[model samples]
Target: MNPRALRAAGPAILIVAAALTTIAALAYGGAADPLATGDPGPFVRWGLPMAKLLVNVSAAVMAGSLVLALFALKAGDREFDGALDVSSIGAAVFTVASGAVGFLTFLDSFNPELSAGPEFGAQLGRFLTEVELGRTWLMTMIAAAVVTILTFAVRSWTATLLTAILALVSLIPMATQGHSGELASHDATVTALSLHVVGAAVWLGGLVLLVVLRPVLDARRVPDVLRRYSSIALVAFVVVALSGFARTLSAISAWEQLATPYGGILCLKVAALVLMGLLGAWYRRLLIGRIDSANAARAAKAGRAFWTLIAVELAFMGIASGAAAALARTPPPATETPYSSTPAEVLTDEPLPPELTFDRWFTTWDVDLLWAFVAAAGIVFYLAGVIRMRRRGDRWPVYRTVLWVLGMLTLFWVTSGPVNAYQDYLFSLHMLGHMLLTMGIPLLLVPGAPITLALRAIEKRDDGTRGGREWIMWAVHSPFARVVTHPLVAAGIFVGSLWVFYFTDLFRWSLYDHLGHVWMVTHFLISGFLFVMSLTGIDPLPYRMPYPGRLVTLIAVMAMHAFFGVAMMMQSGLMVAEWFGAMGRTWGPTPMEDQYIGGGVAWSIGEIPTLITAIVVAVQWSRSDERQQRRSDRHADRTDDAELEAYNARLARIAERDEAADKAAR
Candidate 1:
């Protein structure tokens, strides 16, 4: 390895040392034995955490290198290829480390008998196939192995992106683990942990990649590359900070818990994270502008300063990463959520929320961290884009901004408020959320024209870098996107998903699995957006039907929706009867009665958006006609009624010819 690589290795060294020391200290000194009666030896105890720490570092390198190569590094350059090489090696290490951790975890959790016999094989088979944790590890291992091979063989941007996705997937199983036993915070904890891992991987991995590429990069390109990376780092910082905060809130409910060893480790992690954030801010403020400048002197000075800054930032990031591993080993004050005895609470992570009065709709809150983050990010990015436009003296309509903000707020409320809380128990509230998600929310968002604003605000890259605009354009124009955004397909999905979801096993899947829930909401919002945008979107579409066609589609869709709602109301059979019926609740409507009310909501409240849509389509149709007429008037002005004159002249010739024929005959 180059001396430059040694410099890069410092952060990894610090992270490993810190994690090993912290975990070992916990094993020897603090708290009760995590192991059961007649525990496994110290090697198993220390080995598990050590393996986990290795997995984390390797994951960062694998994911970060791919991300950096995709976002910043130019193709076929030494820096880009080196990043890919690093990703390949990292993924290889990641595979071995993850498999080790899996083996260690199985031993830790089950205390299975040590043997190389048929009995051991049978137990191992059962473990891998039957248990959720085991299955997760098996999936992770498979994904990591795939990433290792792909990263080595493939160097294209698209292939690298796929490899990066697989690397991210490998972490998902790990994140979902250790969160399930905790009930009230189960879903949130899982989501938070998942985001934390991804964010940390990107941040930590990018920094490592930068260090690794120090010798390969040209001095002049350094500023531009770092500038590109800064925005990515900024987003990663927000994700890590928010997710860490969420995990903290879930773990420590009372002030006294902060006094414990677990809290101390958590605090250490937070402090390191906060310090790193400040360092990042300093880099953004002081170093980036100086670096991106074309002046040779300024660029040279900024380059040296940036290297130093990155080295220090990596150290701090290491501290956080290490403390994270240690924190995993440390036991929290609360694990199994308090009083998950009630069926409603056990199933939904909380008791059935208050009934859907007008008051409760605005009052109650049960946040889904994933959607909350999405909403917050959406609002912030939209406002930032609008602000950037204004700063550039470009005018964006106030109505568009207002509509975007309202749409984001509506999304936030529906996902993070009472609607989420009661949606599981009450079919009526679930229908309400569906209408808001699919109809009401899209109504606001489509008018906002977010895509147009983003395309305008984000700087265009001519250097063939795969930036945000490129990605967006690719999505819009790709074959899959083209098909999905087709007017007929969009309308079909919007209506068909509802029937297919409710009638099939998908609804139950959504209820039982958090990821399924995510899919349900995500699909609803996307399909709704596609359908609504097909009609009234100000942004460019691949192919927009004429206003008349749009109006016809709108009417047909509304008629179909009305029919669906009516059908829902007339149906006597329960949807997901087993899941909903079993949730023990003393209050509100019975499952059957609740299903009836849900149908009523679907039939009645669903039409309000349809009515609104019909009105909008009519207005659009009228304006389209007016625009056509204006175009005709302009044509008349330009030509001075030439076509009309030609038609009259033709008629006059025909009459003269006829008169001549009559005279000749006489």
Candidate 2:
């Protein structure tokens, strides 16, 4: 097909191609058939997959259009409007598809007779409330409907961002649908699947948006937009690959199991991904340059080449998406080994890691894919900023760069290493991770001065598009930042969280729920960063006390922090003894003793960072005094000591007046 024709037909081609491919794969996988007993018939089995296929495609369209719109297009422009329009339509489709799938699933799960009677309505209502699957889809449909309205009604940057976030949130329910199976790594499975879905959406939807907007984009703007889209696609490619690997690992036990039908489908998806990666490499290496720099005749040639490449990539994406749907339906190769597992395996989806030892801190590893991504991204962006500054003949401090790198690595180690391995069972390990995350990591990180670096490095966007720099600027100045970064508020959170967490069920929740653990980590880290930043950070904050005031703030906070540790040490009853004590560890100390060790670490080692903070604050205070003195001297030099001279003259006049009064009296 000609480029124009291909551009018009891209979405249709992807949908139809993916639908047919998914149907074929499902048939081959035998997911199109119901069980032999109490069969719900072919309709439920067949229709469910089709509805799922539709949901995936529409979700991609919704998320992709908004992501590109936020990243590349200018507000109040035709392209921006067109992007929003696509998002709205996609969300509407997603809503309808979600409802259809929910209904089909109700039929498949409960095998209720289709009826127009009130009884059927009551049955559906009960299913929506009573069953997890039914509730998941119901919530998904509701979220989609809301997204549809928001995308259609709002086109501003902030609105677009919120809408995109809601669209992403809508996918969370779908994570509960798949079979986590015998190992039951529900958290990992959900996380991996969610990342895969969002990444694929960005990967596929951005290209589709570009194709859809072809008629409106001139060569000048097209290359710029294409480059932006390429940047997003690159990130998406990495995320999808890593998340896919994680998801795959959880599915089967061994590499040899790839011979299974399910594994064969997975291989098909992987091959498609490999081909897409190669195409992306080709685009970056050759076509982007050609398309951006070519003349009229050559430009036409480049456009044709780029569009053809895009079309071919979309076809491969279709295969991957289709294969994914099929793979979801098929059962994986057996993973249940003969060796029995502890309760931890059933609770957390993996066996408890090996016994904790001092050597294991450096030797053992259990990477949280999400935080690994965060650490990697943090290092990558910081280095990129420093490089940009250096290339522009501006200097960023070498120490700041070193500190930033150290901070990121430390964060990775604490979150994904042996500390994380034993945190759930051992109180001492948990405290070690907490101390590092809350105090040690932030001390190093705050000195890195990321916000200051970002402000210096990222170019400002003036096209009414909220790019990285603009968003960062907005966030830094946002009301939320003002509140959280307030010295008093930060101090409150830093100290108060300790009592609230251990005393309440929040600590237990963090142990039991993956998301709660994430929240706990995030809250502590931010609270720590804010507190440190308030005292001595080089970065700009909304509000900071004078140097002496900062010193006082630091002193008060340190006392509370130390006291919290001391209180932990003094606790007669165990904290969360039911969970930590009941872990049945054979190697570690008794839970109560471990809690004592944890308290000691909290009191002594935690104070080490607090002492460091005090020293830094004192140094800053001394330097602040010197700076004020220098300013005073500069004022004297500027005004030639007029104030001092005036004061001396007033004293002389008073003396003369007193002498005259004395002479008159004589």
Candidate 3:
């Protein structure tokens, strides 16, 4: 079909699907008895019966269509082929469904009986309370549809630019709307939700397109296309997984909830995700290898198997999305109750007025002395390793090993001392510890190329078949390798964990308990590693990004961080440790001092790493361009030389002809 016809089909199908879903939802709601209501539930009181049905059905349809689109992408067929047509239908259906859901919600806002529950009176009142979330999700689905359509028609740059704008627009409801009483009432939910929706769309949409449309494309170019998408998919998976985990942990409060029905559902979702990860690994290992070897039959077989696994994964993802919708309406477990403990209890029954303390690092003698020693030792070891390595060149034997050991020792010291001490107060010191462990330390260690160095060190110590050498290779080549490297999965984990910690009662719980601290520390380290690996060319992970694409990814991340910081600053209530008030640390130009500082960290200091990343990408791009230019210049010079030789021969032939004519005349 012509491009114009194809474009028309996309929007036209979407409009029809939306209209049908709206009609279906209205019919469904009308069929149910209006008074057939259950007990006044905490969340159900927030909306009308019809509104609820409409929203749920619309959400389901959108989510289901998203799954279809993801499967389509994975199918790997031609852009305008039958698979593409099917995927376009799915996109259109999701768009309409989302629109119907959003419109019904707006309509429900006008009904006086919608929020007539004893808990929260009036529909407007309840919606005002929960409008932020409604707006967030509604905006998200709409934006996803638009971006998906754009991806089919526009160039990557244009589509990406539009997607970014849409992402910003989707953040509005989250920022302005109040949270459910069960969850944190602060504005972090806005940032968290924004990340969640955008991450999910990019991940699911990319996969759908790849699955459905990849196969029908030019057969000879399939490997390159797959490789390109694989890299993108890996990043998308990482973002989705990290962000999802962050949101979950931030919302969940009590450890006991893990055994509850709500927690059980969450666990099931996680298990499904794990299974999906396994399927993805199989594809990378079996199918990708075959495609690389130009084995068309095996590649096709692997493709079919991959689609089956993706279909299963999508079903589970739908379950998870549905559960998420339910969870939004359900009160988080009782354990999530915020500020449950009295101020007196938190302050150890002290009747002292809160006082602000800054630059008090030296007050804690034990921590101070330990950190000092650690600093001194780290400096000494670092210098020693540098000197030794510089002298020995690439053959430097024990220096790299010594450096790695010293780094590990430093990490332990930082975590055990300052990290532990800060856990006691849950103050700025604790946040400092978090940054050190997650962002600062990882930055230093990753660039040191520890994995590569460790691999070489093992090879030197063993006969290559035994010890750590074999183990390193095994791990890199293992199924887990692809799971962690999947773009959607890893990104989900990285971004999700951050949301989970701050938004849930888990924040306070972690501050109160040792185990909570441990969990936080573990998650922080893991997430940091995954994020850095995705963005930076560090580990031997089987993914690489084109320069332009990497720049766009970096921009998207920066926008997210900036949005988070600004949103936090605008919040009226405290979102961090409540005991911050008890500790006198709450004093500043305003209560938002910490948030402002956080934003500063995100905006100013965050740019340092990003700048470094940009430079690296720029260097690579320039080097590639330089090589290409040199080749072109050499070829052009050769062509010019040949032309000059031809011209000279022609002149010589003319002269010979003239001489022959002169001889004949004589």
Candidate 4:
């Protein structure tokens, strides 16, 4: 296929492939089989999944195009504009597809009569207004519509990035709707599904956009673009593979269940995904370089091979999409028991954990896949940067690397180890995790100076496109960063969040909603990091407090922290009584007693990190003064003590004047 022909036929190929595969998969799996009672007919049963498949493909294109444009293409170029146009068109399709899915879902769910009458309209309205599934689709449709406009109108970097984020957020509603939220390990299921959807979209959509933009890309830029896209696809492959596996575990409990229809569809999806991954590795390793070879004949041959393989990859992606949609309709073998059996289960959707003991503290593990991924990525990227610098014979300190690695490890343990495992059941453990997230983690990470390392290690991009280094520099100097990193503002947020989060409904929200919990963790982590950065970070910042001022700020915040803990200790009524008070644990301290212990943990253990920070500030202060004195001595030595000579000459002149005045008086 030539570039022009591929550009003309790319989207058609993907859509046709997906549509045909979805129909075949649905028929084979009997996913669209008529219900024994109250069937919504073939149209609704079949149309729902078709619409859903369209939603998936369209969303991927929208998000993938924007992301690729941001990272790979230079701004103000035809290729960049073309990518955004593709994204806008994709968003429009996404909006329509989401609406179709919504209406079809209502039909499949309620089997409402097909009518134009007010009664039918009223029922439909109620579904959209009142039902959770209906609301989800409706929100998705609205968000997609908004994204469509934003993508079309915005061409600037910041605006387009925000639009892409909005586009990604639009997928969350869809991710939460499909069997994920009502299952065992609901939190993990939801997180995995969300990541899977986003990752798949980026991978699939970027490929489609590349095919479509082939004519627009300059011949010289092809290799670079291909390499960049290959990098993105590699990361997406990892995310999709891992999250898909996690989602699979949630659906199929036993290995033998692979013979079931649901499992069969899942297996097919897995095969397609794995095959696509292999194809990616092959091309990324071999074809990307050859496509831009010095030999014209070789370049032409490699280009032809690459484009042909892309068409094949699109077909495989279609198969995977079809199987996924079918699996959503098929009932899973692993259904969780009802949460109504116990108060703790009802509240958390999981049973109470084993009793909190010294041994359990070390042995218990409840991995949060999201944070684990974050920590892993952090460590990997940091190490890669350090390695890059080392290979170039640029010295990056070993201590910084060690601090960064240890910081990431600590973060993993705090979020995924025993603290996370029992935080919900025991107030004290939750407090312990909170302190670690806010203070302990930041203290370790701030000294690592990741920003400084990135600035020194990551290569600069001369192209208008933004890469890791560009983005890091932008973020560090961005106006919002300046505000947040200011010593006083950082201090205010650090101390103020403690009071505001605990006293308001925010704490309760965090206890109930996974989104809220994630937000709480992110907010506290960033706030603490900013505070520490102001005090002792080696990273460049807009402002830093004097050492004495830093100590004073720390002391003031410590006092407030202690006071807050004391208040918690003195509480007569339990906080979030409906949640913590209702957990029916057989072997733990009473709710009130646990709360008191939590207060003590916050007051005493939390303050230890603050004290350490204060000490660091004092140490830095002493070193700063010593450096100033050394500089002064070096200046005096270089000039033969010129300052002292000038002072002595002035004293001598004064004494001579005084003697002359005494002689005149005599």
> What's the TM-score of every candidate structure?
0.94, 0.92, 0.43, 0.96
Q: Model 3 misses residue 437 by how many Å?
A: 16
Best by TM-score: 4
lDDT by residue for model 3 (324-378), tens: 4434434345433334255634443222223334433323222222233344544
lDDT for 303 in candidate 3 is 54
On the 0 to 100 scale, the lDDT of residue 149 in model 2 is 96
Error of 4 at 372 (Å): 0.8
Candidate 4 lDDT (Cα, 0 to 1): 0.88
- Clash totals in order: 0, 0, 69, 0
* Each prediction's RMSD to truth: 2.5, 2.8, 17.4, 1.8
TM-score of model 3 (CA atoms): 0.43
- State residue 442's C-alpha deviation in candidate 3, in Å: 16
Model 1 regions lying over 4 Å from their true place: 1-21, 24-36, 179-185, 292-298, 337-339, 354-358, 658-666
Choose the strongest candidate by lDDT.
4
Residue ranges of candidate 2 with Cα displaced over 4 Å: 1-4, 110-126, 176-186, 336-341, 570-573, 631-666
Write model 1 residue lDDT over 246-356, tens digit each, in one string. 988888899899877787777777888889889889988898788778797986687677777776776677667666666666668766655677777777776566556
Please list the residue runs of candidate 3 whose C-alpha ends up more than 4 Å from where it truly belongs after superposition: 1-99, 103-153, 156-196, 251-256, 295-297, 338-666
Predictions in order: lDDT: 0.81, 0.84, 0.49, 0.88
Evaluate residue 18 in candidate 4 and report its C-alpha lDDT on the 0 to 100 scale.
75
